[model samples]
Target: MSAGQVIKCKAAVAWEPGKPLVIEDVEVAPPKVHEVRIKIVATGVCHTDWECLYGTGKGMKFRPFPLVLGHEAAGVVESVGPEVTKFSPGDKVIPLFLPQCGECDRCQSPKTNLCKKNWANTQVGVLADGTSRISCKGQQVYQFLGVSSFSQYTVVPDTSLAKIKSDAPLDKVCLLGCGVSTGYGAAIKTAKVEKDSSCAVFGLGAVGLAAVMGCQAAGAKTIIGVDINPNKFAKARVFGTTECINPRDHPNKTIQEVLVEKTCGGVDYALECVGSPVIMTAALESTTDAWGTCVIAGWSETEAMNVVVEKILMGRTLKGTYFGGWKSVQDVPKLVDDYMKNKLKLDEFITHKLKLDQVNEAFDLLKSGESIRTVISLF
Candidate 1:
């Protein structure tokens, strides 16, 4: 049996920042206590992976080198470590970067999805035990955000994965691991979008489209999509965007002003999928001053931004979400079921399909805005 033994596998390794990931033979150690080894089936190329790849994840901060970067992926449980009673071999699962440990205070609370056992106590790139489980050419390789789905074989804590239905397609439901879940939940859960309410979504990326889809599902009447790129407008419409706006169309008026004018004051809800502080400000201002909610669903490289306090003083609410405010272990499975039942859209998000060898090309497509969600089939 492969249990208790190291597994040699192929993975896209980020040896250094600002360089393409090199396909390397990596040795993945067997799972430790309460951990599970995963045989990745299909993984989605997310923009966060790109952000982290360039060492610009949070802000202008440098990260450890030789890391495996990826979080959104679906796989089968290869082996279960000691005390891992929840999952077993052959179980279909999705690796979650935002883990939901059961006994944590945040996990018990209904207000936030951020967990306390999020490994802040440990080193930046190591597991909970204070060391990495991945190595390459006799050198240590760091795990990226705990999941490291770019690797062919990976180990994650029991709380770091969600078990999905057997019939759910790994290729499609993998989107739920990150982008889809983040965007959809931003609108449905965080923003608590009301039925027949007017909404505006910024960015028109995968997450933005997912938010639009969520608004549609919630019975939104007028959904406007805002983006700099006009190419994404058509796809935004398919995801229930009632109209589209390009910031370049109106040079004189600010984005928020344009949105406010369009909605005859402001939209009832606004979702920012782009991680720009400027866009976040626009999203906040483009909401109805009376009880309008703006959810920041994007990751910004700029650490902080100045906002108009009068906007909030006028009774508008501004909120932020990590991983779409989802309790990952519990809700991800339900999302997969939703996709399986055709209640959620997954196919439209997938613009390209490629093999593991073409991973750099996939990232290139993502970088150039040529593809939405590219599924890299490893099998």
Candidate 2:
């Protein structure tokens, strides 16, 4: 394929909410100004993608259907749009749903990682130009997030990709695009977990395990894993959870109460990877009253929470992270380097691997909570 030429490829598109994705041949238009076209090799299926496809949260349901829904992916730059100077063909890259347009005020600030470029608009299913580049059966298929790695080829703004080392494995490092980055950064950057501090990560999925890894890497001495599923305990231990607690095991006391008692007060850090508002509240209450920190790493639902103001009044900190509080273009490549250096683990997060045609089966595994992450090999 050449510049300004349309490319034809296969894509897994979800035509309706709560439905399986269909393998369809799609037409990918050439990237416009400041956009880059990528040929995705491998993509990781995440809970957010499943939520978008299942249409559970209002967060992702707003994106129109007949959509390509995979955000955590690694690919090679196939072409660059006019006036795009940062990337070229053959550069190994990871598409970032959270873009970093250097021109924005937030991009210039050190206090925040959000770029006010085209985020709000992209969530509505269009790119910077208020249009989509993917089409199937002569109909427009909205892109999922900005990555849409479920497709063989996708076009995203140049600001929405991070260039990685050429020798890195796309199949493995693809995870750094979402879950790994989100969770690991949640503990390392957002929580700033200190050495000898105590941490409780609620949820044992790939993101939670990544958080566990982050806590361990940050030198936290007491890392506790909390989940209802005991089956995840073994896997969580491998990721550095010193103790695993099944909430159901303590029937009489609240999970937060159990955590407070176990820590002799409350944990120094509580990270919630579960999206439920109740769990969010519990995680906050599980923190040390004087100097406890709670970070909501999960994308929460629209439901209102009845938070006790006393939780914050006692010097407790409650906050949340967007993309793990890391600037996408700047930090993602460093994470890739970490993976390359063996300082991070991505292979363990992938529980299953399947072809593009098995995309529905991947979703089924996700629905059953039997897989941490299912990687789809687009080749």
Candidate 3:
């Protein structure tokens, strides 16, 4: 503890969801062991952030009031904890939405993207050791998803920080932390998309388009983008979507029919990026018979929607994917490199940018579906 350790900053606090975001000065503490202080350069306004604010009709869980909410972000390391080894002040870094220690058993396992050791710490919105690292006005506050980039500065474990090339644009590359990684990983890693395979992504938002890019990367010859909004087709095409189908155009028949004709009896893999049960149903129904894989990439309240089990009799499999079934430290840096090399379409994903004060405006645009992605530029 140092005599001049006191610090103050601004953040968007969710005292209550469905209410306006509370922007006010907040206090932050110094980094603890294995932790690093990050000056958030940019953070993406994701649907999951909104869900965390307004509990999904399915009863989404979150910590009590005064939580700094954000997950996908990129920035510069402002300070480092006593035991941090891989990073230091001035290092360019992206805060992973999910933290993973490279030495953990789950990090070694292929089936799970989650690192088991951090479970208890993440659940309580504190450090893995059950200590509060952030406080506001002397009252302890919870860090949303470990890296709460909604604030100007936040602390995260060294394992949660992915150092990237200093030359990479933090605003564009920030999406890779969560949305891009989650969607692309679901398609390539979880679904293990085969070359020339047929796939359909049911949502053309940031994550959905990332899925489209993932499909293209995986060598899927026929990639179908499904969304009710016709405007999304333009953006979907940029990500290598060969076919864009509007569910409204086929009003008489279900989306499954359109996908069947376009993909030849549905698709070999279906990625559900929209949280609605209707879209979930469409995702399952659009799977190919005998061996189709349907991956749920959206966040929704479990109690709000009923799982229709009858459609899965054809040997279709439905699974949930988090952080793209990836170990953050290993996968994120590679994705950043791909973005830098022009192998990935990150610019296509960012449609807007705002500062900390404009966060609510970003949310308004998000609610209107007017943008593919909105970034809050803290730098």
- If both were scored by TM-score, which would come out higher, candidate 2 or candidate 3? 2
lDDT of 1 by residue, 67-172 (tens): 8888899999999989899998999999988888988888999998887574762226778787778999999888887788888999888888999898889999
lDDT of 3 by residue, 74-180 (tens): 99988888878899799999987577786777887877878855666765567766765667666777887777889988888888889999898998998988898
Top candidate when judged by lDDT against the true structure:
2
Query: Against the hidden reference, what TM-scores do the models get?
Result: 0.97, 0.98, 0.94
- lDDT tens digits, residues 133-224, model 2? 99999998888876689999999999999999999999999999999999999999999999999999999998899999999999999999
Supply the TM-score for candidate 2.
Answer: 0.98
lDDT of each: 0.90, 0.90, 0.83
Relative to the unseen true structure, what is the C-alpha lDDT of residue 370 in candidate 2, on a scale of 0 to 100? 88
Instruction: For model 1, state the Cα shift of residue 105 in Å.
Output: 1.5
Which stretches in model 2 have alpha-carbon errors above 4 Å? 57-61
Q: Count the backbone clashes (under 3 Å) in each candidate.
A: 0, 0, 1
